[model samples]
Target: MSPSRVTYAPVGFGDYHWTVTDDDGRPWFATVSDLEHKEHCGQGAVAALKGLRQAMDTALTLRERDGLRFVVAPVAAADGGPVLPLDDRYALTVFPHVPGRAGEFGQRLSEAERDQVLDLLAELHGRTPPETTPPAAVEPPGLDGVLAALDESEGPWSGGPFAEPARKLLREHEATLRERLAAFETLVARVRGRGAPLVVTHGEPHPGNLILGDEGHLLVDWDTVGLALPERDLALLSDDPAALTRYTELTGRTPDPDALALYRLRWSLLDVAEFVEWFRGEHQRTEDTESAWKGFTDTLEHLATASG
Candidate 1:
């Protein structure tokens, strides 16, 4: 891997640090970065970089010994630190450069492609179950935590269409549905707390992680890895219901609505909190975190709408 020839893929800021090439052409990626939230996927995700690194390392070690598919191909550690495209107190891990393009991935695919993906999932799903040994428990943010995360000086959750809706929903449900929500919250926490047979995930198994290849859909983006909490991972698909059906069809099961709701709202708000933190630091503009704000609002609206 030569730095002179490497040009980063133009997705993230900081010089798109990676050389995208076929396996034959020479595949590699590397970078050094400071802990700046905005430069990463947004502020919300930035704070978790350290936790993400540990999770990835654990995942990689599991893969090496287990030989998983969804997990990428990483090398042994270098002298300085972990062998990866990054090592900035956050992470640095690379894979065998899975060949494929995002355009080719699909949840709503032709019969053949869908079947292929299901088969691949079945095979991958067989190797390891959700991880139980090292339980990476995700605690539901209590009122104090959620409010604290939302109370950043000028983060995304503020003064956006999202805030109005979220606040309105909270107000509306504060009294009528408080008990139900508390119960639901406990259920959501319990589900995640009850560890699963840990399997390798792309961390972020959204459509973005999908890569179309001869072998079928190869998952990418091992940023958020650990156990396969389908509720959490699957809720990432709330923005797309069709994908939910496809997932259900493939798994021969339907996801629990309450659990899905909790995961969606939790992550969506977490994104909001991150956006707020990022916006305060990066730009002093009103509309900087509009996307997250919009998502936050929409999540609230969707939940309110669902409740009605």
Candidate 2:
């Protein structure tokens, strides 16, 4: 099918994405992301796509056993491959449009909804890690590198709409940033030393990744699925005592407090680094300039709070 025949529109503020309807009237969601930008962010497209296919297979297995409520659709090429090469610069993947609303960050979910999400996570973590799934690459935080580049630049920041805000945040919060980096390094060492049990973590299980669909709550965005400490997924729900209780009650796994803290800090640092690169024009332009700038500033504020 020609992609041009489908009506395409932006889905969110990150990456180049579209909601398209095929000629047969089937709805699909398509994402076209720059390979170079993905590599710069520590995700090589080939490995990432492999992990995605592995994740989809695992999720489908769990769904068959009634252990999972979510569906992971891997659109196949004519030859039955999972991913389609859009061009030399970008890759494309299409998913059936889930008829549901995505959970929004900063919005409070009802007690029932929160419990449902916690239950879903419990099921996901309780699954056996697929043998084909590779271990996640652990990279040192990138904030230090971003800081170094900012320090080396001589002129007033003028890269893009996010440039000045990024500069100001980096300069103003230099001490906190340094402290957080050191703390993150220490935590990484401590966690590695203990050799915590590895499980299939969603990497990001926040409400924003949860879809309230007609059938049930569905967890989308398998891009970051990997074998990691269960706390990698639990950290998002750490602040909710009821959710924590539900998870432990359902999965019989206790979340390590230190690991939870470490994952939260790691997430904040990663977001800051990614958005800084966007401000520096390392990524292809897919989202509106103003929206991307606002996201960058918001991420900076989140980093400041996380570090503080």
Candidate 3:
């Protein structure tokens, strides 16, 4: 498609987005993912791209082959691949701009919306995943940095404006963070020991990724897609006990509290680690960094609250 215009869509985190209009006035959502960020996939650059390609392909299979319509997979490029290498530092993928209202991150879904999502998730969990799909990640990316930050006896980090503040925050909450990490490790052991079956899971199935359109509730963001335990997806709904109970009724498998806690702790730890790395890297005072600073402090507090 020939792009007549391209405008940035300042929505969501972790991936750059743009709305491209074709010559025929058709709108398409363009996503440019940073190859260096290993948050979604478990590795950097090459391996991350490979994992993402496999994940996107699995998304396509779910929509086209398995007839799972809720999957908002990427549109294949000219090379017939879901991901197109933009440069060494980034990759580009285009998606059909689904007409609907998109949800925000951390927005609580209503009961009806929750039920609908659980139904979609149930259908997803029941399907057999593609062979190319990678295994779900239990370890959060950048965890080593979080641990290292806690070990540091220095005054502050030297990344940029947020660096010193982030170090201070980490220092203040070091004890709670360490305790939570230990609890997380224990929970991870329990979940792993259960020997439960893994399934294709949308790693971040929060409201921000959900699109309430005429077609129905469509889930965007496929980078974190992988084969994992049902709890990985169900854990996002831990805020609502009823949703967990309903999901158990639908899938006939009760969600384990330990697994749920593991994922919850995982999310907070991952966020803290990612923000720490960002602030420690060569960054500057920008809108994004400011946001990252807020996220950094917020996640630290969230972890502390959980520990409390």
Candidate 4:
């Protein structure tokens, strides 16, 4: 089968994506990302895609019941396979482009909008998945290795403008960083001891992943979706007490504060580590390097604040 005309989408970080138009002028979204980058996060491309497929299936199930709006799953190729391999460096998947504006991180949504989001999440958490779907494995935040990489790099650090700044920021924040690491370990132990029931979680449910469309709100970016304690999703919205209360009222599931704390710490640590790795490696010279450096520093501050 002939492929569609691909135009760069230029929307997200961490992946190369495009908007493709078929001969009939119907547009779809396509994503191409490095397999190794994903593997570094503790899951390879194949496993990540499999988990995404399962999560999309579950989301569709909830959509049918609650009128939940979500991004359409990647379409299988002519051979009936979901992922199409481009080469060793990149793999491809395509989906229907839902029209909407992406939400900003610090932007406040109105009460009605918040209720809609809570209702959607309640419906999602109430879903039951196939028995064959395994629970997501918990991986250490792996920030230590990232710190080591920064320490071992010999400088003149001039290969990238942000290189020296990133190294300095890491050193300045070292004590706070170590404290957050210890706090994460302690939180993990408490959460594990409680033995919360595992549910499918959209690992990163921040406003950046939400799309407010003509019909309703839609959650995009399922690459991190997997079977985990529901708190992993709830932690992102924990700033709003009313949202948390409404979720429990809607789903009849109690939220665990310890688990929510652990997940929030986990997000901050992982993000700081990822940005550091990106800044130190081949991505150092990219146009995004400066923003990446700022993000790393901001995340470190977030970790420090949360730890306190």
- Candidate 3 residue lDDT tens string, 45-145: 88878888898899999999999999999899999999998887788989998999999998998878888898889999999998878887798878888
Candidate 2 Cα lDDT to native: 0.68
Error of 4 at 239 (Å): 4.3
- Give the Å error, residue 162, model 3: 1.2
Candidate 3 has an lDDT of 0.85
RMSD of 3: 1.3
**Per-residue accuracy of model 2 over 1-308 as CA lDDT, tens digit each:** 55435655645434577877777777788877665455322357665455555665554455555456584555666866555667655667777788888887656777788778777777777788766455665553456667775575445667765666667766776677777778888988888898878888777677777888888788877666778888888787664444578788887776777777788888777776766676665333445656666766676667678666
Indicate which candidate wins on TM-score. 3
**Each candidate: what lDDT?**
0.49, 0.68, 0.85, 0.70
Candidate 1, residue 274: Cα displacement in angstroms equals: 2.3
User: Which residue pairs come into collision in candidate 3?
Assistant: none
Compose the digit string of candidate 1's lDDT tens values, residues 1-308. 32345566644322224654553576765433344542222233355455445554655655666665555544555553343434444444545556677632124455555445544444454455433223333443334444453343233345434454454444544432344345456766666575444444333455555778776676655545545555556565554445556666666655566566666656544554454334333343354345445654565555456556
lDDT score at residue 274, model 2, on the 0-100 scale = 68
Predicted structure 4, TM vs. truth? 0.86
3 or 4, greater by TM-score: 3
Worst 10 residues of 1 by lDDT: 36-45
